[model samples]
Target: MSQFALLGKRRFAPFFLTQALGAFNDNAFRYALIGMATFRLGMSSQALSTYNNIALALFIAPFFLFSASAGQLAERMEKARLIRIVKAMEVAVMALASVAFMLASPGMLLAVLFLMGLQSTLFGPIKYSILPQTLHPSELVGGNGLVETGTSLSILLGSVAGNALMAVPHLGPQLASAAVIGVALAGYLASRAIPPSPATAPDLRFEWNPFVETWRVLGFTTRNRTVFNAILGISWFWFYGATLTVQLPLYTRNYLGGDASVLTLALALFSIGIGVGSLLCERLSGGKVEPGLVPLGAAGMTVFGIDLYFVRPHEALLREQNWWSMLSGAGGWHIAIDLVLIGMVSGFYIVPLFALVQERAERSQLSRIIAGTNIINSLFMVLAAAFGIVLLGVGLSVPQLFLTVAVMNAAVAVYIFTLVPEFPLRFFGWLLVNTLYRIRREGIDRIPEHGPALLVCNHVAFTDPLIVMACVRRPVRFVMYYRIYRLPLLRPLFRMAGAIPIAGAKEDPELLQQAYDAIDAALEAGEVVCLYPEGGLTADGEIAPFKPGISRVLERRPVPVVPMALRGLWGSVFSRRDNFLRRARLPRRFRARIELVVGAPVAPEGVDAAALEARVRELRGAEA
Candidate 1:
């Protein structure tokens, strides 16, 4: 289903609105404060800069100081109740903010900023952790997409509203004050409608010491290798975005200038780009949490970021006109496209990682894990600000800063992908399968979202494993013929996938036993292990007699065996129609129509090779 449809469901809509309103109020209050200080207060440049820095720091400090405790509190209470409570806190903060605005006191407004940050920090953990509890595993990606879309757009609108409202002549402060409190009240109302979500961890031991518990929270987060790295990926995204956006006003005024309207235009393009890209995730991933899109997004961000340096006007357009003049000027479209693409691809890069963390982290510890991520995110954003300030202070131009970040993104992406090779492996599989086939899946969700499972399928082509990997969201370890596993073009992906290389028992008994050992171990660890019970790719577009490898795998592991079939791949380029010589195959369809028909899993207790083969043949039907 389209992610937009989620906005209509009570399961998602209320929580979405509450979160969106909170984001809206946040940027609205912050930007409006900036407008008031810069325009109304007659503060000097130095005082204004100091105030902005202090405000940013005040906002970030609570995530470090209170996020872990907030996460624990969320775990202790029912989630909907906690969210409503948080929203109530927001209302109180905004009410105080209204008083601060009326007083026109920077000191009081700064205190309100810290309190707002505290409220946001309290909401952050539940924001991410609640999703997996509320959403189906299949809906995870689509749900994340909607949340991200709502967030980016809200931020843009809030920023615009804050600035516009604060610029009003006599009632700027009153307008800003009224808007924030109204938004807070609205958010509280929305939160009240959220369905009750039972706490995942009840009767858990409490930790009250912030410093010690903070260390423990972060330490526990590192225990899951993939989840920790995904968290890092998210932090890196915040760092990249913070650094880029913080420089935009100066970038607009100095580099792409026509007027301040150009800054708003640039911001709109980037923000809308994120919204567009976030909404696209549901369709692109086919409702699965697919991280294969990360590398693609990272690559796009790097490419366009570099292109941005070259496409900008060497000198600013110092005209009296606004964004309209810039939009119709030379290379304007190039600049707009670069920013939007950066935002769009960043949307692709971030949504999957967030879903991956929520989907993979333990439910009981999920809130704490999210809290750890928030802490890391806070640090990264601070570092981003520092990084930008240092580099720009030293004399780097804004465009040069963009280039440096783009290059650093390439480096960081490689490091992360190396740490978790599943990302690139899935990338190759997803890219290859999608490019070569128009695929359909039936009963794919029956493959199971968790725990040990043995998947037995009829291998129709060399691309069989890739097909299954792309369709199934969870990682699958395959036991395949050693030669096939060693395919020159696909070897890296296979190695990354942990495909166990097997030889015939007669040819190499040691290797056969080794493959069995690996499969057994993987299943014991609650991983899905897939192997073609037919032993090899079909030579004549027909199912071969099932081999005994299935028996050996189940003898030790005794896991559920999921039967799957690959249809319409027998005549494809990767099929054995020409005996493994790719160029020699005739009638090899590119972008071929294909289907993966999955049967309900058979209990390991009574499953057998012949029965599985029969089931697979039935599922395949007459497609081959």
Candidate 2:
């Protein structure tokens, strides 16, 4: 089903609306306060600046103080009930904000900002952790995409509404106040329609101390190295985004020489770009949590961000032009496109990391992990603010800052990819398979979701491992020939994937024993191990005899063996059809159609190498 189908379902729509409205209300109230401080409060420029900064700090303080406890609450309490409580609290907070608006008291409005932040902090853990329970594994990426798109749109609309409504002559504040209250109440109503989502850790003890719990939650996030690095990647994205967004107004005024409408134009383009990119993720990922897009996003961010620095408008055009005038200017479209693409790639970068964390983290500790992520994200954002300040203080132009950030982004991506090689490995495999073949899989669901299993497949070409990796949802460790495993270009990827490399016992008995030991250990730890039972790629367009080594491995592990076949790959360039070098000179077989067919698994007790080979050959009937 299309991911949009989710928008119509009771399982998703209500929660989505509730969350979007909450975002709308938050931004509306925030911009309303800023509008008051800027134009209505009659304060000095320096005082207004200080007040704005203080307001931001007050808002972020709650995330640092309460996110850990909030995570624990979500895990321990029923999620739907908790969401309703949160919505109710938002209504109360907005009601107070309305009073602050009426009284025109800066102190009261600032307090409301802090309260709204606290409310968001409380909702953060529940917001993310509930999705995995409510949606199917297949819908996780799509669901996240929709949520992100909705939130971005809400923020855009809310900011516009808040500023526009507050500019109304005499009753602007009253209307703005009423708008936020109404939205908050509507959010509460939407929350009422949310179906029940039970707590993941209902029996767990609650940790009330925010400091201790914060440390404990962060420790849980680090328990898995990949999960930890994914969280870091998420945090870095927030940092990058915060830096760019905070500079937009300055960038518009100084570099683009545009007015207020132009700033709004830039913001709108970015928000819409993010919405477009986020919605596209479901289709691009084939309804799975595909981290392969993350590298693409990072690379795009750097490329376009650097390009943005060079796309600056001439200073002569800096004279009081409106958004339309700016658009008609020479360099205007370039700047707008750069901003939009940056936001779009940001969507690609973040959604998968979120899904990866949800899929990989311990289910019972998922809420806490999300809370930890929030804490780290907040920290990064705070650091981004400081970094921007230091750069500006050093007399760096906003465009120069953009260039510096792009460089920093590249460095950070490299560091994170090194820490967690799975991301890059998956990207390489995804890129190679998708670029070279139109892959179709049949009966892939027969592969067990968990526990040990031996995957026996026909080795049709040198790229078989990558093709299988791209098609399967679960990670598979391949048992490959030592020569292929050690191929200079593929060695790092193979090692990262934990592929076992084996040689003939007579040639290297120690290495062969180590390969068998690694395979046994991987299977015993409940991982899938794939073996090309044909032993090597076909020199002819035919299945080779099955190697008895598979039977020997099963004798020790006694795991069920799934038989699979690759069709239409025997004649590919990767196969030794004529000769490796000779085939390379032939026309590239780009996007060639191929299929992977899986047969029902055989029990360990009844499995035979020849029988398995026959089953695979049957699956690959015409191709073999």
Candidate 3:
């Protein structure tokens, strides 16, 4: 539970150190470039800002252009060796950066910046793709949190060190260059300590054309929808961060009437918030990679960002005030608080999504999928820049821009959940089932790893779907009645689960069409879709005639049909025969046995609706 335990092992420590140092050096070099442009070279503010913006643009650009290739490289090569090569490249780039600093050459500095971006792009796939390989599934969330927190902290420290050293007058360039080289050397040494990671795609042929290759990489998304959407979620976070991080300096100088030190305050506060939130992941997740936290984090980001926009910008500043002054609540502290909140929420938002992608992505294609993800992230960041430019051109102020971004985040989060409702709906069902049922699952291994599975179960209670979902490791889309799907209390819950709402044949033709389409899509996508074949809940604690819904879906897409039986929920409140007061007044320790017994998959050709129903009834009889 102690967060530091994440770094205590060989699996994590080396990679963590290497990544942390790289992040530190990245900021250090960027800061050094900014310093040389501004004070050392006697450039104007406008020129300095222009160079800084260009450096930012260059650094982020490779994520789009090279992410797919880098991801492929990660899949094809040994991660340990790849990291070593990457660190070596960093060393060479730092050497160029040293020369640029010594000569105070803007051209060389800009070129070195691009090299740094390229190095990061190459490292992107290996960086995240290696975690799932190295750590147990349980440790993934905590481990990612450590890396994120450390990276944020390193950036904060690196920026301070770079800017502070640059102010030393006599020792500025030497100190900055030395620091960059030192970090690079440390990263190289740490990378050497990394455990060897086997190649995911050893025989993968290298593609020469980036455009074509990038398009090919996207096909992986279609195969795994959850991983793909999680990738989108991650990219959206980058878009959100891009908008805020890029504007902070200008906001501090022009709006808050502060100098460089105030910018440091904003950065430090934000980084510290990330560290705090990241560390909390272990506790929040209860040591599991809980994707439920993703929505919560996204919600927080939007709410706090809006609050930040509304924060009154400080009109004046005391010159004597330093970093501590921002905390003193005299000038622009509201903006500082908003920054901290956003960073903290972002930490919570991102770590789980990354862990989910790693946990869900196929091991053989994880790196490639990660490569796909990096490309998307880069693309979104570009889109974010475009969005920012458009907003600015439309005469939006910094605060107003922040507000718009907050709204945009909310819209995007809803869109993602709508596209993949299982995350949120499952979370809802999970909460309810965990709270109400003491479920004991047996024969869980009977569920096939990859294939369509028909789950035939005895009617137990209205809450059966929730109980089944809670015990099953995978998400399930349940086929339920239109009325149940429209229950105001459970509508949000079902909506998220992507539940299929069916109408009786005589009720509505369009609803039936939608139901069949949803069921087909769910099974075709390799998801588990469950239905109560008895047509409705057992009103008299007896299984009814099996409905034809399961057979129809199975007929379309022949996969495994698993027959299940639930026992001992006949008199519960959720069951039909419950006497509300008596059931509520029942002793707390009811000592009931409720179970889900998974049977073998039914072959499509041999199974009919009646035959499947008979098998389910037999299982229920056996259990009873």
Candidate 4:
């Protein structure tokens, strides 16, 4: 079953609702506070700005201050009890907010903000740690995506409700306060539904000192390079988002020249985009954590951001009109379209990074690693604020600031991609294979986990190797003819993938020797090396005589051979049987089901090339 389908089952549904409600209430209360400051209290522009800035500082500061200790607490205690206590704290904080709104006291509002921040800080550790307890490893990404999408949607809805309710004049604060309290209460009830998540480190000592705990948690991250990098990627995303979201109010008022509706539109667009991207992650990742999408997302963010700078909202006439007026205006559609794409791609950018972090991190220290990530996020957010100030000082307008952020995104993406070429290389290969063919696979479990292994498959199409590479998580070195390996368009891909090029003895003895040496090295390093036993694609859609090259490799390295087959590509242009233009017109759409069937591995000593070839042909379900 798909990961998301597991979440719908009773074990996960309640916990999902609780977390979603907590996010909802947090935004609802914050927006309610903003609404009161703007209208009910007759606050000055300076005061409103100061209030918002202080609120941001107050909330984020707690994450850095308390996350380390809180993470350890989650690891040490029963997560269920801690979540309940946090929910209770939310109740009390919202009650205080009720009194603050009623009395119009700024002090009480700030206190409520700090308390809410503390509540979330306590909730953060348990929030992530609880998932693994209830979910299978495969379900983690989908569950995380659902939570992310739900949180974004809730914030969007909560902001609207808070603003709408707070506009009710006399009863605004009362109604808003009541609604927030009710949401918190509902969250507590949902917490009851979450199955008990046992602590991973039950006997672990709980440290109260944040500084000591911070380093301890960070220590756990040093062992895993991928996990550490994934955390950094997530932290970078926070910086990107905080830079944009925190500036929207100013951007809306000054650049867009619209009222509240402009802010609403921008936020709604961004959130909706994130939701779209998050949901689509499953399909894009093919049920595995793929970080290649990170660079893709970062690239889009930069390109669109730079474009947004030259967009000139005022030129589009979006600056002077209401939401409805803007929609009706000419060229407004262009700006709207751009914003939507930016938001959607940003979503695409973030979801996989989170999944990658979770998948790679050690289960025992996952919460601590997450805590370290939160600390880094807090630091980046502060940096974002500082960066924005510098940009503002240099005479950049809010729209121009957006442009600057976009360009910076490109630089950041390049730096990360360069540091980890695997991500980009895999993404490039996956893009080609997925776009080119409607591929399928069965019994892929027969593939070996490690060591020198040979993959023997019926030669089918030009793109078959790429298809196999995409489906298999581990990287493989394919042995192919020197000419085919050096094909104009395919050469760069082969180079990145480390494909070994060979030649027949009559063709080039030196190249053949290099190919053998490379294949041996790959086997010694415990990598999968794939080869076509027939030495070329099938011309008449039938199996050819078995060649001894497969046996020669086995005689040298003696690794397990996984027999695989590809079907449904015989008549296509990519297949050897058809001309390019003729093959391109066939194997129409969703009807294509090309299977990669892996039969049981053959023991090396007894295996012969002809026997292996016949076995592979049988696995392919081919009549010939």
Best by TM-score: 1
Models sorted by lDDT, best on top: 1, 2, 3, 4
Query: lDDT per residue, candidate 2, 10-126, as tens digits?
Result: 999999999999999998888777667765666663465456556766887788889999999999999999999999999999999999998988999989999999999999999
Give all candidates' CA lDDT scores.
Answer: 0.86, 0.85, 0.78, 0.76
Q: Please give, for residues 444-463, the per-residue lDDT of candidate 3 as tens digits.
A: 66776456676778776777
Candidate 4 residue runs with Cα over 4 Å from true position = 1-7, 37-54, 137-141, 313-322, 329-331, 444-456, 474-495, 498-562, 579-593, 599-615
* Candidate 4 lDDT, 1-624, residue by residue in tens: 665686678777887788889988888888777767755676654455556666777777888888898888788878887788888888888888888878878778888888888889888878777776776655766887787888888888877777667768688888988999899889888888777778878888888788988888778766676567767777788888877776666665555665566666777787788877787777787765666677778888887777777766442334545666665555456667777777778777778777776666677887887788888778787787777766766766667777877877787877776655666877776777777766676776567643568888888777778778877655678889899888999797678778899999889999988898899899987789888878888878898887887777787888888888777777653765545545445543333456677888877887888898788888877532
**Clash pairs, model 1 backbone:** none
In angstroms, how far off is 283's CA in candidate 3? 3.7
Worst 10 residues of 2 by lDDT: 312-321
What TM value does model 3 have? 0.79
Q: How well does candidate 4 score on lDDT at residue 336?
A: 73
Q: For model 1, what is the alpha-carbon lDDT of residue 98?
A: 90
Candidate 3 vs candidate 4: the lDDT winner is 3
**Model 1, which residues run further than 4 Å from truth?**
37-54, 103-107, 313-321, 487-490, 578-586
Better of 1 and 4 by lDDT: 1
Better of 1 and 3 by TM-score: 1
Q: Which residue pairs clash in candidate 4? A: 573-583
> TM-score for each prediction?
0.96, 0.94, 0.79, 0.84
Candidate 2: lDDT of 528?
Answer: 93
